[model samples]
Target: MTGTGLDDERAYLRECRAAIRRMAEGARLNVVIGERVAGDRYSAERLGYDLRSLAKELDEQPDGPPFFGRLDFGPGSAEHHGQRYYIGRRHVSGGPGRAPMVIDWRAPVSATFYRASARDPRGVSVRRRFGWSREPVALTGFEDEHLEAGQDLGVASRIVAAEIERPRVGPMRDIVATIQPEQDELVRAGLEGSICVQGAPGTGKTAVGLHRAAYLLYTHRQRLARGGVLILGPNQAFLGYVSAVLPALGEVDVEQTTVDRLLARGPLQGDDGEAAAAVKHDVRMAEVLRRALYRRVTAPPGPITVPDGSYRWRVGQEEFGAIVTAALREATPYGVGRERVLSRIVAVLLRRAEARGRSASAAWRRGMTRALSAHVDAVWPATQPEEVLAELLGDPASLAGAADGILTPGEQSAILWARPPRSFRSARWSAADAVLLDEVSGLLERPRGYGHIVVDEAQDLSAMQCRAVARRSEHGSITVLGDLAQGTTPWAARGWREHLSHLGKPEAELIALTTGFRVPAAVVTLANRLLEVLTVDVPRTRSFRADGRLRIRETSDLGPATVAAVRDALGHEGSIALIAADATLGPLAATLRAEGIEVATLDDIASAARVTAVPAAMAKGLEYDHVVVAEPAEIVEAEPRGLNRLYVVLTRAVSRLDVLHTRPLPAWLAPPAGVQG
Candidate 1:
């Protein structure tokens, strides 16, 4: 490229940036003016909020390129044919009369930048990618792939490779600049139907899910903003890791949280065995809770007697019992049905007042109904989720009655609290117990649902947990992202079908992302050994980069070996993670600290840190440029599906993986060094 061409590109970029700054300034002025001349308090507050959001959308990041790619379309193809469109994270307009300075990547016109290729140009004449410095101020270089010249382009784009191979420093960056055509399809998938993505490590599943949320929010802003979108990850650590992707992509309203946090009931205490937890998480538990809660609405002890003015209105026990039974049988929420039952009692009192030849005023009848509070309390008590769960777990007799056909005696016993608290307020609930409580709460009262939900790492969510999440999306859609082979939890999903079914999204389209872009070919090849043991059929993933290194080091001193590995990985360009069993994190961190090495744990948000010691269990949705696995054997022995855990640990590396093990590696991972098949 000539110097004049480079200078022209630089000049154009500056013009775009300037236009964005002007738009942001206009947004700020609108906020100020709207705040001062508001019609009312509510209007003022609403205008302030909307303008602030607009300003945020137009906010420029010093360290991010204003635009990453540009597409020049041919004549008669688009409304802006013969014009170039700069694709960016958000839309930036010059003014009402002038054309948009930059188009959001989610825009339909900008789709050509990602979907166009040498074979299928989609009427695109030229596609250009801009390379920026770390600070992203200067336009260092630009690469142009001309589609109209009939040039035979290669299989891969150098620009895309450079962007993908960029050394990431902070939390997971948005992949807007390097989204592949296949990924672009999923990201632009409509908001009407849910999508289930089964992607291997380095397949960009998490990134795709987040980007899809951004796209949905962009396309259906008013609809989604009203009900809102939610991104559910495995844990807070994972949530924190991917927190910036949406914001970076010009979306700031989506809620990111974990299943535990979403269910939000108890201080997660106590533990249950895998079997026990699975049993409790069974969908049948919903039925059991229903029976237990409805059982409380038994036959009224006696007829209700209401004294009105000078008359005593007496209703027979048979009539009251029949109404209570019919109300209980109604397919409605407990609270809703209870209200109907109260109305029925009111009707009975009104009829009795009419029969006594005494005219009762509306106010008088209401008073007579209110006077039957004692009777109503005894018949249909207001039951809370916690109170119902406590009684179900505390009273063995009640448990048996509810779980007769639903759960075996052993299963019931397993779920029963050993030392049941005196009340729901004092109950100590486990994570699984919290899920059960959420179920009962939903049954008693319909929980609020989101417009859309993105459930990353969905494979690890149990049936009941999925149901809890599904309840929140009952009227909306979801994006389910996970790799069945990476399911480390004991109750991990058996397949996408099972998971989708449990999530009440059986119609969701299952999309498989088999290309590994982050993990190197060698690392992915090494990790796929665990697939033989996993029952589900997971597609083999191919990596874009074949230069990733994988080495297994057998050492006597594992801690020192880990320290040495971390020291060596620090010499690399990207983030380094030292993954170990949960029990080994404390000692390993202490060892590294003793060695004068600054180490951050997974729980700590350490995006800037060059090195982090992450527990093997928490490494599911996280990635690193260089990963050092300390004692793979320990990770494999840590849980029931530890081999799957090992696979997850090994595939977290984007560039290199160093397996430092003092014990023998799992036999399924690889054969003995000297042995042949």
Candidate 2:
């Protein structure tokens, strides 16, 4: 903490930065160099690609310092004796004696920096955390804890506390520099199995998921780089919020998308009622769709006879029926089973020809198989998934037969399209219909799975949506992240067991993040009150932070009061979000702009403004340092599951929350005072 110490740390930081720049220069100068590269296009192309990727990975962010912490080891120890390593977002080398100047945070040696304590130093003598300013990015100060000297500062280090309390103005930043011990465990967990995180708001569940992705990519780059990893968020806006996390960690291959976009079968021109959509998303619909698709395979019409050059091959109806029955019993994919039926039927004739001492060449077999196609198509008709789904929903007979005992008459009636289109290609598909079409598509042919998938806001996924995600991850592992209390959809899973069961990973470990460092005590308490009236069994979060402020004001005129609150919030040093119901958000934005306040929207995260007017529905998976909630009563009255929506709206504040209302506040909020009626 002295001036001399600051000067020494700054000098080391400058050296590390210079090493990074040199590494970047090396990657750029030596892109593609190999013997035989001139003749072999494949090798030249691959080397070119690998070099470009390397250069891009070495590119550091312009905001923060390369390394955030330094670890000094005790002498005569085993692994890191008499050595010190600066832990950073990326590796920096080319130091004196060809040593490492900065080690990547995902490396195995950096575990001690996060795991060591006074009781068990793990051979670590001291851990030093550096504080830096982004403007020109200079080393401002440093905090050190000497474990060998038995000096424990507090529950959290001063530098970490400062980082958590920093203002939020742009997109969500990565938590690499401030990851806690408990979160570090999850981030370093093995990549063989799946993990379900039941994290409350501000518990950093999303960040934990993203960091775990980076860790897996760092640890198992070769295994994962083949099939690739995927990240699924609730919406595009939420995706944009956390889009920069992996790239900042030197990972750029992971994909981020939504469930709706993943299962987009056709243009979404029609919509189903909530009841109808819920029924379509039920687990039993999987069986219903299967039954409707396989209805095309039935008993063989008659026997078949085929003629070749100077030979006639005949197959009996009994044998043909047995082949069809065997293919049906195989229970493979629809296309595979159909091909199995064709192969078996053709082989019977080939064997009979061989038994007669006849030579069947390759050309003869091809001709015979082609000739038998018309006969095979008659019994096992070729069908498309869209045509099957359209017919099943359009024709009452097909629906009743497929849903005879699986679905009730009322449930069957709910999903039937009232106005069926003339052609299957021209059908108006809803989002739910797209999921069903995806289900049928899988039944027709199994989908290719990814290497790993991290799905956020998973509590809001329905059974059908979970099934779709499961298919994409059938051959890989998954990291499921969600808060049960924040589930706002009508069909949201009330429990993790049912949700994981539908996702085909029922044995996945379910971990709860009960201690939060993101949301403050006041906001956690307010959100917990709403959890009581609802149906979540997860425990309330205990915020590790001590300084989350809450303010409530009642005024007859919401416009002036909201404008006044925004003006007051502008005095703070972070982003301000004025969240209200959909009906009130536009008028409130007008009021703020009419008063010469620059107000943007929450959906557009890149909008250049300090104050953003966010509708309560779109407030989930987002946070602001300061928040003003205008008319809590209206947020709870705008939707069917409004109280759940209100819970999501109340917990988005990271530093402070302001509630301004003209109507009475919800009784479930449990304010110290009674409602302002």
**How close is every model to the real structure, measured as TM-score?**
0.94, 0.96
Identify the runs in model 1 with alpha carbons over 4 angstroms from their true place: 1-4, 56-60, 76-78, 151-155, 273-275, 314-318, 348-362, 606-608, 671-677
The Cα RMSD of model 2 versus the native structure comes to 2.3
Going through the candidates in the order shown, the clash numbers are 0, 0
Q: What is the lDDT of candidate 2?
A: 0.86
Residues 131-220 of candidate 1 have per-residue lDDT tens digits of: 877763678887878876654243276767877877767688899998888999999999999999999999899999999999999899
Global lDDT of model 1: 0.84
lDDT of 2 by residue, 1-677 (tens): 12237877778877877888888778777774532354678877777888878876776445468899888888634888878888999888965588788899999998878888888788877788888777677788888888877865544787898888788878899988888878899899888899999999999999999999999999999999887899999998788888888888888888889999889966898889988998998989999999998888888888888878666777889988999898888888898888888888778888887888878799878888898888888878788888999999999899999999999999999999898899999898989998999999998899878989999999999999999999999888999999888888888888999899889899899999998788888778778888788887888899988887888777899999999989988998999999999899999999999999999885666678999888888888988999999898898888778888888988899998988888877667646553232
